[model samples]
Target chain A: MNKIILLNNRPTGKPQASDFKFTDENKPEIAKGEILLKTKFVSVDPYLRGRMSNAESYVEPFKLNKPISSGCIAEVVESKNESFKKGDFVSGSLDWKEYQVSNGKGLLTIDASIAPLSTYLGILGMTGLTAYLGLTEIGVPKKGETIVVSGAAGAVGSVVGQIGKILGCHVVGIAGTDEKVAMLKSKFGFDDAINYNTTKDIKKAIATACPNGIDVYFDNVGGDISDNVHANINRFGRIIVCGAISAYNETSVPTGPRVEHFLIRKSVLMQGFIIGNYVEKFPEGIKQLSKWLQEGKLTYTETIVEGFDTIPQAFMDLFEGKNTGKMIVKI
Target chain B: MNKIILLNNRPTGKPQASDFKFTDENKPEIAKGEILLKTKFVSVDPYLRGRMSNAESYVEPFKLNKPISSGCIAEVVESKNESFKKGDFVSGSLDWKEYQVSNGKGLLTIDASIAPLSTYLGILGMTGLTAYLGLTEIGVPKKGETIVVSGAAGAVGSVVGQIGKILGCHVVGIAGTDEKVAMLKSKFGFDDAINYNTTKDIKKAIATACPNGIDVYFDNVGGDISDNVHANINRFGRIIVCGAISAYNETSVPTGPRVEHFLIRKSVLMQGFIIGNYVEKFPEGIKQLSKWLQEGKLTYTETIVEGFDTIPQAFMDLFEGKNTGKMIVKI
Candidate 1:
């Protein structure tokens, strides 16, 4: 029997395991213009939390009692479509199911020889593209400039810090744990890393870490941490608002110091970046990210859990700061 | 003897008369390569409030016991410099003095034949440039889109609303009083106006006014009013951080709802604008403004207080929303 996960309820604040429902299903059959795909890897992310809520967001919310979908790599088990063949691997937005039927519409035939199939859901996929495009397009980091990344140990943040380092920037990472902080500096090659959870005064810690002042801020975690980063921001700074994972769990509206004074006083620019909007420039982003990965200039880490049943728990673990890098579910 | 207004003390909160000292000095004679200037119109602005404090800003803070300077119109009383002759009017960042000597550095020779002398310090000058540049460059309002201007009765806001109309946008203005609100619709050609001071709920009022949602916001007043604007902001919105008159006088830091969720959800862009940064684009900005003014598409209002003695009072009144448009003191 095939298994599938569905949104049992629209998550209120912090998502719980009960919010999702998993059930057994018959393997979906392939039609004349379709292909039957066996799910290989599923990408679970903090941004997925936004889609779990019934609010207007960058992406549409997942419907109740329907299959929850995200970026997934699948193998063509049975093909009736001319565009895809049996045993071929493709990656695209696919549903959470052991077996599903697709018309081969948005799927990209990714090569397994170049990298691991699971890496297609991470460093070489949307994760890398988000980091590369968001940092270069929005952050616009200059050589010798200080670049700070919040949620620094996560999928996008880890990649962003690596890219910043490659660009010859004074890259700094802010994460929750000392272990993640150590990984950011030792593994990701960030100049420094601040454990925000341990730091009594995040603003002061940022000030010390970025003595020259933060010129570009890659914000994945927003709220008071972002507010503290603003305090240490430099004149003519650029803030790339990627994700507000920090505020995603809050039932009440998050309040903090007004930004107009910082913006006006410093002549700063803050832009919200959604990677889907930069599809036309994906080739450029992918090419650069690929080159860096090949040259060993860029490195990535992932927390993979085996089995289809671990998907919801893996997603929920994201908010608890459980995952250090890309959180992936391999079935 | 020459008359001058000097900053007596760095204001702690709202500026008082005691914060300024009117002093007398001997009028300076013009030397070779220098011109004697007689102050004609003194431009008093809310932004001057920022300069009065020792805080670092886009512009330098006013030094204690030193004559405060702003965009002023002056007549050439005597000329030893080739650039200027007797009776020629020039505008520049001039000192707050009845008579002063200049070497014609950084001064723009104004044509009284084109507009009034005081108009050089206003619509034809920095105020016009700020509105035009901040709105077009940052706000980037597209035709049929909704544009909202806060502090819509003031100098920059008034011009911003007019320009929004010219750009074929649905222009909405937010001001403090019923009179200013009426003027915004009647005189400034704003499609809708909201009296924020009297409005029970600013966010609801904004939502009602902008049914299509706010595509662009020209923010002159920050704090709660700006927070309300963000609530009504649409996806891919643009906010121009021109000024924050609302927070200028606050003794403590002004706090509000955090902007990350709003920005990230919408893919919005928020940029702070200072007119000085766009000096290279001044010619382009001036040409557009000049054409609009000449064609009668753009009209301006001024609250002119008589004499240099009223300069400090006129500036202080800006915080009270006393000025309909540009606040000037005719010396």
Candidate 2:
């Protein structure tokens, strides 16, 4: 029997454990040109919270009673497809199941030789691609300019901060905890870091950290934090809105201080960003990111929990800010 | 004697007559590199309201008890500069006075035979340039896309709608009055017009008017009107934040529905646009606008108030939405 997780209900506010169901099903047979994949590493992300609701988004909403799917690393147990062979590792947006069948359509062959197999789901996966593309294409952080990363300890934010430093920018990170802020400056080489939770005024803290004013804002968090960032934005500032996890689980539409005032004040360019918009340049971005990782210029951290049963709890822990970087489930 | 208006006070809300002081002085002399100018047509714009306050902006705020200045077309009564001669009509940012002297640096000599002298203060001036550069550079309206213009009857919005139509976009205009809405559709060639004042549900009205969804929004009126426009914005939508006339009078920072949620949902690009950022490309834009005017492809409306004393009232009327087009004070 193979275990699978299903979206049991539409989450109202914060997603509850009852909203998901774990069920056992017999592994299905694979026809010709199909490969049997055994789940290895599952990437649980904050964005999954959006998919749990049936709201129209960049990606399709997860249907109720259907098996949940996300970025996953798996081993090919059996393959009738010539493109994929047994014993090979692959990475793709795969279903949350112990065993699954794939035609190798969207799956990419992964090798443990170059990097850790789990990294294919983290630093070398959608997370890395998102950070690279959004900053380079949308934010366009110029050298000598200040780049502030909100949710700076998160998987994507951590990478964005590193890339900002590599681009010869003044990198400032904003995280929830002092521990994460310490990691951002010490481990990630960020010029400065602000623990937003401990700070009396996040806006004033941002101003103190970036004395010259923010030029490039890689915003992974939205709401007042984003508005505060806007208050400190410089003329011709570029804000790459990657995620708004703060308001994702709210039952009703969230409201806050209007943005148009600040936008006009600084003549800023604020754009909402997603990786899919630059899918065509994924190979180019991945190549650059991989090179940086190999050259010791880039580093990543993952909170890996053993067993597929721990997947839901690991996801719930993300909202509580339990994980420092990428949160992955090991099977 | 020369009559001049000065900023008597920084307006707290809607500008009043008490905010301006009229004084008399002897006609000023011009230096060797300067020219004497008799004010013809002075452009009283909504943006001038931003400069009335002592806030950091693209242009310096008006000084208390000092002469107020704006875009003006004046006839050269006496020439001390070789570049300009008597009887030549030149357009420049000039003080609100019946007689003033200029250094001839920022002034552009205009031919009365080519276009009416008053047009230099309206269609062929900053009003035209703002609409052109904002749409072309920031909004980037594509042919066959839907473009919405707020403050549709005002100086910049009226031109933005016409340009959208010229670019083959389905143009929709949002105005406060049914008369302005009618003018937008009939006179400005806008495909559709929404009267936000009478419209019960502005969001629904926008959806009905722009069935294809808004791709490019030239927003001159920001507030609930802009928030409503965001409801119908398509993926990859580009918003040109030209003016926030609605909130300009409010002493406090106006609050409303937050924008980041919709920005993320649609991957929209919202940029605060001013003509100054593209100052280097002014000649190119002006040439294109001039050609359009010459070919009869472009048309403009002006609400010209007579006498120099009307300058303050003309500017104040902008906040009331009294002008159907460019508001100009002729002396």
Candidate 3:
């Protein structure tokens, strides 16, 4: 029996598992010029929580009573379209279901031999593309400049810090715990790492670490962390705000240090970016990421859960800062 | 006897007349390569507030017990240097005193034939350069883009709004009073105007006036007005924070909405700029501004106060939102 998880109601805070229900459902039929895909892996991301809420956002909010969907790796079980044949592995955007029918608009064939099929859903997927686009286009790191990244142990932040180091910048990362901070230095080649939980004075700590002051701040955790980062930026500094995970689960508008004045003080440039807007650059970014992976210049690690039923638990772990790198649910 | 106001004390808040005291002192002999300058017109700007504070800034803070000084148009009464002679009009950074000696390094001979010598302090000086550089370099306005300027009646803001209109942007300005707003629309050619004081909801007011959403927000007042302007910005919006007069006097760090997250949502770019950084482009900017003035394509206005003792009062009046356009003290 095929089953799907429906978003029965909108979440107010950290979404409870009860908000989703998995039930038996009919397999979708493939129309002409469409292919039938059996789900192999469905990627769950923190950004999906944003889609659940009804707010002004870059993408449309998810509909109530509809199955949550994202970039899913699937197997083409049957095909009505000449482009896709049976037993081909493909990746595309679709509902959280056991099976799906695709018109091939967003679908792309994947070579499983390159790595694992799941790698496409993480490093070479939307997550990696986001890190690439945000850092390259917005951060614009220069050699010898200091680059600070928040949420440094997470998927995007880890990559951003690593890229900063690769570009010959003095990379400093701020994480929630000692373990994550260690991972930033050991795994990502970050020059300096700050565990915000243990730090006595964030600004002083950053100033001590980066005596020259920060040039680019890749902000993932927006709140007080962003404010402290803003205070340390040098003249003509750039801030690429990718996510505000600290504010995502908030019950109210999160208040921190007012940083509007910092813009004028440092002549700092702060910008936000979404990956969807840079679709044309994705292939080039993926190609570079793939080369780095093959050459051992870039490394990625994921904390995977065995069963699809653990999706909600894995997602909840993300908010609690349990995952070190990309958190993926493997079937 | 020539007397000048000496910088007596660093001001904690709004500087008082007591912070400065007129003292009779010896007219120091002009050394080799130095010239004696009699102040013709002295500039009192909002940025001087920063110089009074001990806070680390782009320029050195003004030292107590010394004559406070800045960019002023002066007449070379006597010259010990070959570069400049007596009776030559020049512009340079010098003491606030009636007569002083300056080395030739920072001095430039002013041409009085083209425009008024005081115009060098407004439309042809640092104020004009600020408006030109901030709009052209950072604001990067495209033709027909809606340019929103805060503190529209001030020295820099007025020039920015007029330049925006010249650059083909639909200019909208925010001012403290209806009169200033009226001036923005009638005198400066702003497409629309918003009196922030009278408006119940700044966001709604900006939204109603700019239906397409603000493409570029040249922020002069960085408080709630900036927050409202930032919230109403469109995708890929650019915000050039030129000054934040509203927050300069605040005793504590002002509390408001977190704007770093908006960078992610709108792909907004917020940058701060000082006009001094673009000195290389100054002559070109002046040439264009002069052409605009000569052709009657642009209109310039100034609120001139006679005498030098009113400098403190002029600086204080800026905080109270008194002056309509470039506030200048004629010596």
Candidate 4:
């Protein structure tokens, strides 16, 4: 029997584990030109929260009563496809099920020896590519310039700050807790990290942290935090709008101080992009990320929950600021 | 005697003529390498309002009890400089007075035969260059794409829409009156025009006009109108923030709907810039603007208020949307 999680209902303000229902069914079978995959590691991302709503977005909404899907690291249990042999590790967009059958079209056979299989679901995968492209293409961080990133303890923001440091920038991070702030400074080598939850005046805290003013801002959490960052951007600054995890669960569109005046005064540039736009550059991104990993210049951390039943809870924990870094479920 | 306008007091909300005081002083003498200029036309621009406030900005504030300065087209009455001659027409930053002295360091000699002297204050001078660079470098309007210009009947915006038409784009203009709206479509050749003052729902009107969505937004008026445009921007859209006339007079920063979420979902690029940023490219801008003028592809209009004493009133009229195009003072 196979266990799967289904989106039973849409979320209101904050998502709950009860929103998803677990059910058991027969394991999917493999046919000609297909391979049967046993789930190994499943990624729980902030962007998935956007898919739970019916609003128009970069990706389609997850339908009710349908199996929820995300990036999954799986092992081939049986194979009829010549390309994917049994016992091989691969990654692809797969269902939250114990077993899945794929035609091997979108699957990429990953080498676990190069790095852990879970790393392919994170630092060497979509999150890493998002950081690389957003920072280089949009943020365009220069040496000696200051780069500030919000949600600094999360999966994408952690990678973004590391890349900023690698590019010779003064990196400042904003996270929710002192523990996360300490990890950012000690583990990630961020020049300074602010605890947004403890700080009363975010604007003043950011001003103190970034004395030279911000040149590039990687925004993962948007709201008053972004408003404060905008107030201090230098001339010709670049803002990379990666996500708005702060407002993703709101039933209505969120409102904050308008940014046009600030943007015009400083002659700044702000851009928003999704990782799918750089699909053609994935191989290059993977190569560079892997090289950095091998050089010991980049390190990653993950919070793993040890069962498929915890998938819903792990995803909800992202909003609660309960996870230190990338949150994944080991099935 | 030299007559000049002085800023008596800062405005609280909307500027009135009482904020300025007309005074007379001794006539200045020209020194070596200097030329005595007889002011012919003085420009009253929306950006001048920003200079009236004692705030950090691209340009310095107008000091109280001192003569305000603006772009002036003048005739050289006496030339002690080798670069300028008697009776030569020139344009440069000068005090708001009938007679003034210059060193000719930042002055550009103009030929009135090529274009009117006041055209140097409008279409062939800083205003023209502003429209050109903001549209091309930032807006980046592509053929068949829809380009929307707010404050569409004003000096900078009129030129922006006309340039959009020349670039083979479906140009849409947003103005405050029906007459300006008609002028935009008939005289400026905009494909469509919206009267933001009369429209009940600007977002719906823009949606109906631009079924394909806005590809480029040339913003001059920033407030509620900009909020509506942001809601309808297409994927990969470019928003050029040239001026924020709507908020220049407010005592405090204005609030509106947040754009970070909208920007992130569509992968849009929004940038703010001053014309001074493109100073190195002025020669290119002038050459292109001149070519367009000679080709009869671009035309300009001005509301020339007679007498220098009306300069204060002319500047105030901008906020009230009293002038259709460039507002200037004929001295």
Which one is best on lDDT? 1
Please list, in the order the candidates appear, how each scores on TM-score for chain B only. 0.99, 0.98, 0.97, 0.98
Mind giving the per-residue lDDT tens digits that candidate 2 earns over A85-144? Answer: 999999999999999999999999988899999988888989999999999998888899
In model 3, what is the error at residue A95, expressed in angstroms?
1.6
lDDT of 2 at A304: 91
Query: Regarding lDDT, does 3 or 4 come out ahead?
Result: 4
Off by over 4 Å in 1: none
Q: How far is B20's C-alpha from truth in model 2 (Å)?
A: 1.1
Encode model 3's per-residue lDDT on A240-271: one tens digit a residue.
Answer: 88889988877667766666667777777777
Query: DockQ score of candidate 4?
Result: 0.80
lDDT of each: 0.92, 0.90, 0.84, 0.91
TM-score of each: 0.98, 0.99, 0.97, 0.98
What clash pairs does model 3 have?
A272-B263
lDDT by residue (A170-219, candidate 1, tens digit) is: 99999999999999999999999999889998899899999999999999
Ranking of candidates on DockQ, top first: 1, 2, 4, 3
- DockQ of model 3 vs. true complex: 0.72
- What local lDDT does model 4 show for residue A258? 70
